[model samples]
Target: MLVLNSGSSSVKYQLLDMADGRRLAGGLAERIGESGGGGRIVHTSGDGGRRERTLPFPDHAAALGAVGEELRADGLGLDSPGLAAVGHRVVHGGTRFTEPTLVTDEVLEEVRALTPLAPLHNPANVTGIETARALRPDLPQVAVFDTAFHATLPEAAARYAVDRAVADRFSVRRYGFHGTSHQYVSRAAAGLLGREPSEVNVIVLHLGNGASASAVAGGVCVETSMGMTPLEGLVMGTRSGDLDPAVVFHLSRVGGLTMDEVDDLLNRRSGLVGLCGDNDMREIVRRREEGDREAAVAFDVYVHRLRKYIGAYTAVLGRVDALVFTAGVGENSAPVRAAATAGLEGLGITVDPELNAGRGGGARLVSPPGARVPVAVVPTDEEFEIARQAFALVGRSPR
Candidate 1:
């Protein structure tokens, strides 16, 4: 399976053998159509060999052409008979798509129609879908939506408290993002506990630059932190999450800022960077160690919000068997993990200081022995999840 995550100016591609879930090859193409054309790509083969090159790719088609060439060099081109389908990461599925869908013309059009809900993402997704379909017309193209896993959100959790008529007219509601990561992490956590997913309850904290938390009950997502957009939940590197809606009105009416300005401020100018002029957690930790007050305050605010959600999700989930963390900061950044779970012993949550200080790549528990609620760091595999779903949908002995 070939999984493609298309952004406006870049494309991240991976070729995986879903039979054994081995990544045969992967690469990224970026700076597409930039003036003077210095598009760059770094491809990695199954043997862990890496190569980097620069080209003058004019558009997505050209960029993908280079990717195909790279794959062909590794003896795994797009036309390989073993390849079953291409899975696309479409950001906003709205309430329409609840599962991975085969990409038909009607499905493409519906995804295009969802642009208003995800103005920044769906268009790029549509372009990637069209480009891949055009490149391989005979192969199946599947869309694995980021919101599909959270489709189980009950009405009370999904709906906003605004006027029902107005909210419905504009399709305004909580449609959480990073669902693929949350779903992957939840099941992984269940596995680590030596239980079936249906027999376990867990809270997943995906704390990358873009962060979110989810309460997974019996393999279903009953509640999550991100809502309506990726910007509604955790305090991320750039996004200002969980701000009062009236803040926008205040900025617009009194501060004389336009809606676009307010949007830029919250999504681009806020969060950790907004707080301390740095977004990377490692840098923040270093500065705080050096007695930097600004970094200290930013780190505290970040963890304070994290602890709040941890407590809130605990109440939502009557029994949380494990607390799982994933993504960039969650996987590394021992300081953040220690601080986030510090003093939560009463909830059966306490990081083993010695274990938390150590760093390893694979999944492992950081809680002390026999802790009631275990704390774990499980790396998320969204690409593998995408390929797995796509393979299940259209992967019958590839033609």
Candidate 2:
């Protein structure tokens, strides 16, 4: 199966041998719409052979065409008879799609209709899907939505406190993002605890450039940080996660800023960058170590918001058997893990300094021995999850 995660300006693809869940090939095409320069694809084969090309990729179609050509060189082209299906990581599926579905014209139209809900993501996904269909019309294409795993959220947790008539008309409600990562990490965490998913409750914090937290009770998402969009979650690299809705009105009426300007401010100019003039957590940590006051404050705010969600989700889940962290910052930042779990001993959330500070690979425990709740750093595998779901949906049993 070929898993494609198409973003606005990039397409990340992986060809997997679903029989053994091994990646056969993978590549990335970045700066898709750029001109003059900044367009490239880095393709790596299963045996670690690498090839990079710098060329003009004016759109997703062009980029994907190049990807096909590269894959052909590796004997894993889209037209290969061994290719089963194409799994797309669609960022939003609204409430209509609850599981991986075989893509069709109607499905494409429905995904297009959802553009307003995911203005920056769904269109790119549709483009990838359309391009793949054109490339191999006879092949099965599956859409594994990032929102699908959270569809299990009950009404009370999904609803927003507002006028039902107005809210329904505007489709205003919580539709958490990063469902793929949360689902994968939660299940992985359960496995790390030597328990089945149904026997464990986990709090998964996917702290990447865009961050979100999920409270999973018995393999089902009870509550998540992101709502309606990816913007209503933990503080991100450039996005202001949670803010007063009235701030939008205030910016327009009092601050003399247009809605678009305010939107850009919140979405592009806020978070760690707005707080400390730098978005990268590593740089922020480095500056903090140098006694930079702004960096220190930004780190504090970031960790404060993370800790709040950790505490909140702990309450929500009642008994969190595992507190799992994943994604770039969650998996790599030792300071972040330490700061986020600091002083939470009463809740059985304590990270051993020696283990937390040590650097290693894959999911491993960082909590003290026999701690009430184990803290672990589980790397998320959304691409593999997408491929697994897609292959399963096509009635193929993975070896």
What are the lDDT scores of the predictions, listed in order? 0.93, 0.94
* lDDT (C-alpha) at residue 205 in model 1: 95
Tens digits of per-residue lDDT for model 1 on 1-399?
999999988999999887677889998999988989999999999999999999997889988999999999999998999788999999999999999999999999999999999999999999999999999999999999999999999998999999999999999999898989998899999898899999998999999989999999999999998998899988999998999899999999999999999999999999999999999999999999999999999999999999999999899889999999899999998999999999899999999989988888889999999999999999999998888888889845322
Model 1 score (lDDT): 0.93
Q: What TM-score does candidate 1 get on C-alpha atoms?
A: 0.98
Q: Which pairs of residues clash in candidate 2, taking residues 3 or more apart in a chain or in different chains?
A: 175-228
lDDT tens per residue, model 2, 1-399: 999999988999999998798889999999999878678999999999999999988998899999999999988887899999999999889899989999999999999999999999999999999999998999999999999999999999999999999989888889999998999999999999999999999999999999999999999999999999888979999999999999999899999998889989999999999999999999999999999999999999999999999999988888989999999999999999999999899999999999999888988999999999999999999999999899999999788
Q: Estimate each model's TM-score.
A: 0.98, 0.98
Model 1 clashes, total count: 1
Error of 2 at 9 (Å): 2.8
